[model samples]
Target: MTDLKHLFFSLGLEQLDLSEKEKNIINAFIEQSTPRFNDICHQRQDKEPLALLLGYMTQQHHIASSRWIEQQTAYHQMQSVFQSSVGTEHASKFINQDVDEYILITLLWLLVQGANKIDYSYANEQAETLLAHIHEETKESNDSKEDEQLRQRLMQAFYQGKKTTQQSLFTKLKRMFRLTQQQ
Candidate 1:
């Protein structure tokens, strides 16, 4: 075999490396792993309904616009790094982290917003209810108790129809998430 072909052949032997055939086989396996598009959330209306639910969360529990903006910046930076690590479309498949602070913040935002639309008596209920609404494929994150608590508190405020100063909320979330000052 030629040098290039030999290199590819050598790559096939390593656990981390793959020949084109093995790569194709793995790709096919992954494609088969997921349910069909029609079975998944492929319909526009179906997607919109969920978006509305999330929007409700944003409307109620999300902190001020400025903090979200900051989180967005952090999120985008992480997204860039993630993309570099594993291309654009495949990043979510290979390394599906929260995609940055924005995702967590957005989740927090939605929790605050959506939960607020309902009564506070149902906050835990709301949390559980929200859990049922999502797909099983979504991985639960491993966050600290403090981070979780602070966000829940913020969510309570949103449900209570209040917005505290950005500094205080940011401080709690930053500390909870272990976000650095540089970030």
Candidate 2:
């Protein structure tokens, strides 16, 4: 298994059984989200963007699997797991309002696709509810233009059944570390 997959498994997150195309889409989402996150947050932590997105997604999964009354506990437990696994600095940023909305909308879009391991039985209902929330919250805001464009592209790719090549997670992490050191 790749390092990312192993890390997720160790954290008791879902299996990383995504196809190359799905992995590419997720990578693209992270890449796209990073610049936007940095622009808004004013600080660039190498792993924070990925950690925030993945952590929130995992938290949502846990929440969906738990009873309503137990959701708060589940959310806190997931946060603790992410904090311990990815470092508190990276994981703590997952609670920002803007970041939460962005991740939620994007995650709901992915869940709606219904092609990945991220989908649970109630994922469709959850996705619809979250999407409606997003729409309601953003009704008077124009900041979602970029998000909409990204969503359009992702939807196009999904509908077209396009598959992209993927690199091993180990190599990507190694390269990321090398880049970080050189900076």
Candidate 3:
């Protein structure tokens, strides 16, 4: 029974600081969701049936919010892993905590969307994007004052609109996946 934290780190990945409680929660969620994801994948094959699968997930009304919250919790765990490792080395390099959080959140967003659609390719693309973002952000000395202000403003807007933020993010994601609202 490899724990979730070690599961991510076992492949030479940075370790996230996930508490025992969080491990239990995420592990349980993954365990519970695995069968359904497999079933959905089998049913859909590779067809781009946008609304049906998304609809299926949305229909799980009671647990929908739980899934998103769990996704967020897993993201925090991911951040903790990076923060515990490279965070100090890059702290003084102009990268702020909010930027780190944003990166992690975006990674999580891509991962969740891919998983929901049963598309590992999409997830891998997101991983590449995340790596690129990290490479760009960590070049601390190269960050101009303008970049810093933009980052700060972005973070501020994200935090200020906590409610619609998620909605807007989903909207953007829907577009990325070519999913229509009517669908």
Candidate 4:
């Protein structure tokens, strides 16, 4: 496993002081969210839904927009480093490196946006619920979580929903699935 502390520090997210359980949750989230994120990026459709979700997380006050931007830039730099290092090697080498960094960056960003505060309600309920919504909206899975999605949707789905109301990280997730529900 990646040393969680070093990963966070590299990404400038060490201040979050996440517990072991919290680190596990973030790790699980990254594993579950990766395919969904990649699917959205590959679909060649509008990425606004996920982009909005990312914007909300990366822009949170505690995250410090400037620092987040810098970290994000650093992530890209890491990606470039991985790509250059694996020019003639097996593609998996570069992919694994990039994915690790991606997960770390994403976990840090999510934490800064208050992911750790999510109620999760049941034993692992919150994390799974959150993952299901992303998969549903991104069309990565058929499994559903209607109640969770509805509560999140209505909470965030108001006037100027996209333009004015800044949503919590999880609520902003409702945006991704809700838009797909209409299609």
Candidate 5:
């Protein structure tokens, strides 16, 4: 089982305390989304973008399914927690944004087209946005350099599978040509 705390930390909610109901909602979201996420990863063999996709999906599902009054309560509480943990300036980046709408659009796209058809570039952009927020909140001396390195690594990983497949194809073609010449 995936560790919820690790997932929350990746999502920039590490310091926040979730209510029992919120936890249950998150678990349900994970349960439902995991298969889709797995399928995408299996097809692409590129897991970077899809890493945060699950978290955004869970957040959207939770907000959309909750009653309005409950959502309001949870939103305010989350805002306060974020402000206190990361300071108001950084908190604003997470709380007062159209990110949720963007996430919803991505989710809608996924639902309509299915995970196997996901646009990796668009998904990577969303994942980078989420990581940027976390970088902003946790910035420190030399952290920008480290974060850039991390981003580069993620991008490399995203393309690595394709590179390997291309190399394999080239190798197979070379062997086949050599065999034809021998025959």
Candidate 6:
């Protein structure tokens, strides 16, 4: 699987650049704290907190389509945890190190997935779940003019890259033929 940075470069497309304000508030903190996160994740001491840090950074980035990216990434990280536990699948087992390595790998996946311009549908599904957690703040968040603007920005970024899901003409005809035969 492609690593996180590579995923971002390809999928995020126009969302990677941080603005001056974002640079001041979020980018600075991530730049300062990433090494600490890397250490914790590497050491296998506590991965959750580190994952949260990475998640927040991803959401705040200009993914253009979804702000819930951090949570989605988190979900994927958890899924990998399950995958590592059994060690009965197609994955390699590093003896006792499966959990940590898998979680870290999943975290990287989210990072790159944010930068991804493709796979908008998967992002959309995950974004909805994240929005639910902010349900109470929905009115307050969207009521503000600035928040409204951000919503639009996110929609553009995430939606622009989605491939339409229409069925092919041949498939439609085949289905219709089957239905007619049944009648």
Steric clashes per prediction: 7, 0, 2, 1, 0, 10
In terms of lDDT, model 4 sits at 0.41
Tell me the lDDT of candidate 3. 0.43
Candidate 5 residues lying further than 4 Å off, grouped into runs, are 1-127, 133-142
lDDT of each: 0.40, 0.44, 0.43, 0.41, 0.48, 0.41
lDDT of 3 by residue, 59-115 (tens): 442244334434554555665677687785563443233434344344223323433
Report the C-alpha lDDT of model 6 over 99-182, residue by residue, as the tens digit.
222222232334334434336565555444334433332222444564344334444445432311122345688999999999
Best candidate, lDDT:
5
For this target, which candidate reaches the highest TM-score against the unseen true structure?
A: 5
Q: What's the candidate order when arranged by decreasing TM-score?
A: 5, 6, 3, 2, 4, 1
For candidate 6, the 10 contiguous residues with the lowest summed lDDT are 94-103
Query: Candidate 4 at residue 132, lDDT?
Result: 47
Give candidate 3's error at residue 104 in angstroms.
2.9
Root mean square deviation (Cα) for candidate 2: 18.2
Query: Pairing residues by index, what is the TM-score of model 5?
Result: 0.34
| Positional deviation of residue 120's Cα in model 1 after best superposition, in angstroms | 1.2
lDDT of 1: 0.40
lDDT of 5 by residue, 1-183 (tens): 654334333333322234565445545656666676666556765565434454455455445434332345555677789989999999877653333333333333233222223456754564465446444433423466765654454344334433444555689999999999999
lDDT score, candidate 1, position 36: 33
What is the Cα-based TM-score of model 1? 0.23
Tens-digit lDDT track for model 4 on 1-183?
333333233333434445575556556655555555555545745654434334443443223333433454565566567657765354324432332333334344443333223322431333344344334432334434654553343222221222222344456789878988999
Model 2: lDDT equals 0.44
Superior by lDDT: candidate 3 or candidate 6: 3
Q: In angstroms, give how far residue 36 of model 5 lies from its true place.
A: 5.6
Candidate 1 local lDDT, residue 109: 42
Q: TM-score of each candidate?
A: 0.23, 0.26, 0.27, 0.25, 0.34, 0.32
